[model samples]
Target chain A: MDKVIKGKVWKFGDDIDTDLITPGKWLGSPELKDHVLETEDPDFPKQVQKGDVIVAGKNFGCGSSRETAPEALLQMGIVATFCESYARIYYRNSIGLGLPPLIVPGVSKEIEKGDEIEFSFETFKLKNLRTGKELQAERIPDFLLEILEGGGQEKILKKKLKQKLKELRAKKE
Target chain B: MVRPMTIAEKILARAAGKEEVKPGEYLIAKIDLLMAHIAAARIVARFMGFPAKVRKVFDPEKVVVLEDHFVPAPTVFAANAQKMIREWAFKQNLKYFYDIKAGICHQILPEKGHVRPGMLIVGTDSHTTTYGAYNAAGTGIGDTDGTVAAALGELWFKVPETIRFVLDGKLPKYVMSKDIILKIAGDYKADVACYKSIEFVGKAAEDMSIASRATLSNFSMELGAKFAFTPPDNKIIDFLKGRTEKPVTSDDLVKPDEKAEIEKIYELDVSDLEPQVACPHTVDNVKPVSELKDVEIQQAFIGSCTNGRLEDLKIAAEILKGHKVHKKTRLLIIPASQEIYKAAIKEGIIETLIDSEAIICNPNCGPCFGAHMGMLAPKENCISASNRNFKGRMGSEDAGIYLASPAVVAASAITGVITDPRTL
Candidate 1:
């Protein structure tokens, strides 16, 4: 299992809604690679690199729960999100897409932009590489953990089911 | 442990056929009503790329497509996007398409009778939960979930525990559902009640009309709730009368037991409430209008799924009747739909607003999106009846936004400042 990812962090203020993240206009487009590279803040897309973490204040996904929001994050290769809180659907959408949204109640105030950070999924902890400070977040369920570990829930389930069928057929033979 | 299930849990359990449901449990549900928006065009494009060898559109009639968010695109980019969506809708053979000329999707759905009480309504839009005001269980979904729901007419759900808000006493003058919801956000912050389905009850919600109840249910999304609802009552029954063709028959009822369990409950008395505004950069940065003294606005918008109802229009028309908007201010009014547009004309409300110099636009989400018609310039400030006020929400990133009730927006249009509608 992938235990930790290290990357520079981009910090944002409260109410970073889905519209600002992926935007509505991009929905109709065939490919999101370039658009995902162009983040909401006019200057962001170029600044964000693959595998960077997004650190934000409260109500991170406050508005519409557009899938584009998570898709953009994933397309940009965002590894994880550390926020004060998340909107209900956005939280679920991220997990469904195999991305992690860590709920660190006060991490928004603690972390800053360009700060290298270490994120751990197994222990549900984030370590600020710059400050040597660490924060813990709420742990996800085992089932969801299995999905995240095996890429995504659908992919994992399909793989396990196939393996189980193969095993039963072999036993019968 | 003997604990009672909340209204939210009861509804989720009934749909899922479980005795009890928790917050994070994932289970499949039999969706009663499924809705889609212009964003569903993405699903269509994907379907074109990789055709789904599955059932298509659970119920085409139950799905609705509203070309809101980016209506009358300010740039060629938005225009191109809208064009793509229109073409996709035609190919899909989905009937409930509301083009940019139609109106905001949320408002058009209930106005068109696709939503009613005691049913599960799912949409691609977050504010789809607003339908719960009529006592239906509705929530928003992502494009993938929407596609699955569209094709299968079924999706999974974890019965969420509910938070009951018992509001007592009559509201003071200048206070309305908008003020009450802002107060709830102020007290609870944005995510304090995250993932909890909210049920607003008591005299406040009870006495309110279906329109007023819609305003309350609409903003529950701002409080980070999965959905918001008020139980079925006479008001809903009365509202259904206008939509006889889409009326709920006896088989559509799911009456909660008198002894149904609730997870958490809170009581509030807002009899002496004041005009409220959600300040810039955050919807939960709520404050009474009087608290932010001497704040002036360059523009005022009175429409969106939130305050675009007939009652909302009439009240604004009443305030603006025979009173001209301020010379320094630009005011815009958008009816919720073509149906509302025609009704306003018949009732003389349209003439009243026009006489007051308010620029009336089509029923789409015009200036609310900061696109097309009324984009605000840098450093400009606006007071709107829309749901959100994040940076760049209405125009430039530097533009400031304040959210208020329709009355307050109309009054601000006249005074060109953050003034109380009652004072006007």
Candidate 2:
């Protein structure tokens, strides 16, 4: 059983760089507990809900492949991200941190702020709870689905390595 | 009605056993190159913790290690991070190595001929897209993905469909890759291509040198593209001439298949374009320098892998030749590497810059990141050739940063606000 929590959407245009996500100046400080709240614009992180899904336009993480960008999102308790597109480094960082980055086509045009939506990520669809209009996303590939199920790339490697070790021991026996 | 496959699609389809890969389609391909930064220390520690059995050199010749970022550490933390990377390189026996005294990884990688056209490149740093100038499909990866690529020279990629950018005409006199990319950034406002690869074609791309084209493809990541590229031609062949020991002939050249499909097409004519600036708070918040002219700057940094090449230095020196940098503005010029520095000195580009009162630093990614020497005070503003202008990204959250081309940075060092290099 999973929980879906929706809030008033805050739409940010594409190419939201890692610098804005987690400023390097903050890296000087050792504190990792909700540093997102202290961003130049304080309202952004606070407006987000614990389980809220961020819907972005494109190139969502661009410039400076620092891990702090996704770390800030996770620290804010953001459960998933639905973007029309994402930067290569940013997408991998989010997935590595066990955050779902759903690639939806043309979803940025359909949704507006204050739209009450029901997102069934398991089914890969977003429904307007008030209007009952469902938006479908193109199917995510099986390998990515497997990584998502196995808890990201790092975890998948761990599981594979473990299985390989077991097989090697059995062969020796 | 016929839909022609884009150049990117044609290349990817040739490699892809499967028919088509749309935007969301995740098709895996064998990685061609693996690049890592100093953070490789942590990745090495992970491998040591859980050693992979029967591991020799995973793509030994293809892997490149560079200590570019976090150089000249001001604090003990950065020093330790550098130490970790040094120890790992020794244990891994990496062949292509660039230490802290060297320069930015992206600049070093291609200058040394590690980047090749049609090759898929992955780096630990995000700006790895800079290598796309060599016509390689390059992108950034995190520590985990990097470590995996180090252990197994392969990582899965969903061959990205291409967005064909057909350049309509030539650029204006002062307009360079920075303006073209910034104009494109404004056209799309950050989300246009998102996860797609952008392929630059037509006369505009052909006319630009590999370094200028590198700036365009490099910052394409700034527009949310997975990566961007321009196929190598005689220019790339010329660049790779002496740099590569193994002569790569055109016979082995990989070209796009004729029967491929393109996802979308974008066209732009940058003729008569002006110098652009990404104002503070966001790279996407772009505007021409004329729009926000006379905004005082405390610093003017003219280097980074982004704009630290010899051409960039020449452009800056040309502007700063006889003129002195503004009294309040500290003009810092760092070459991409010792090689570029030596070339600039040999060509008298260094004397021209020094005569203009510009502070010439060593070849490294120093103050562009604001880690050690160039940290800003609150309310300070900087005009920089480095990428990204997010709030507090350079030094202080209150510090305002304007991203510009090397020409603009040098010109601004003269006038002290965002000034167009052409006007000067």
Best model number under DockQ? 2
The 10-residue segment of model 2 chain B with minimum total lDDT is: B1-10
At residue A153, candidate 2 shows an lDDT of 70
Q: Which residue pairs collide in model 2, if any?
A: A59-B224, B5-B260, B5-B261, B5-B262, B6-B261, B6-B262, B27-B158
In angstroms and one decimal each, the interface RMSD of every candidate reads: 4.6, 2.4
Q: Which portions of model 2 show Cα errors greater than 4 Å?
A: A1-16, A40-59, A75-77, A82-85, A103-119, A125-139, A166-173, B1-7, B10-24, B52-57
Worst lDDT window (10 residues) for model 1 chain B? B46-55
Model 1 lDDT tens row, B130-215: 88787788888876667656766667676676778888899886678998998888887877567878888898878888888888
TM-score of candidate 1 versus the correct structure, residues matched by position: 0.88
- Model 1 CA RMSD to the hidden true structure, in angstroms: 4.4
* Chain A TM per candidate, in order of listing: 0.83, 0.78
What are the Cα lDDT values of the candidates? 0.77, 0.74
lDDT of 2 at B129: 76
Off by over 4 Å in 1: A1-3, A19-44, A109-112, A129-134, A146-173, B1-4, B72-80, B98-101, B242-246, B249-261
Compared with the true structure, the alpha-carbon lDDT of candidate 2 equals 0.74
Question: lDDT per residue, candidate 1, A1-173, as tens digits?
Answer: 36888888988887678767754434546554454424355446766778888999877877777777877887776888889888888877777668888888779877998899987876888889899988988887776676577775334434544565577678889
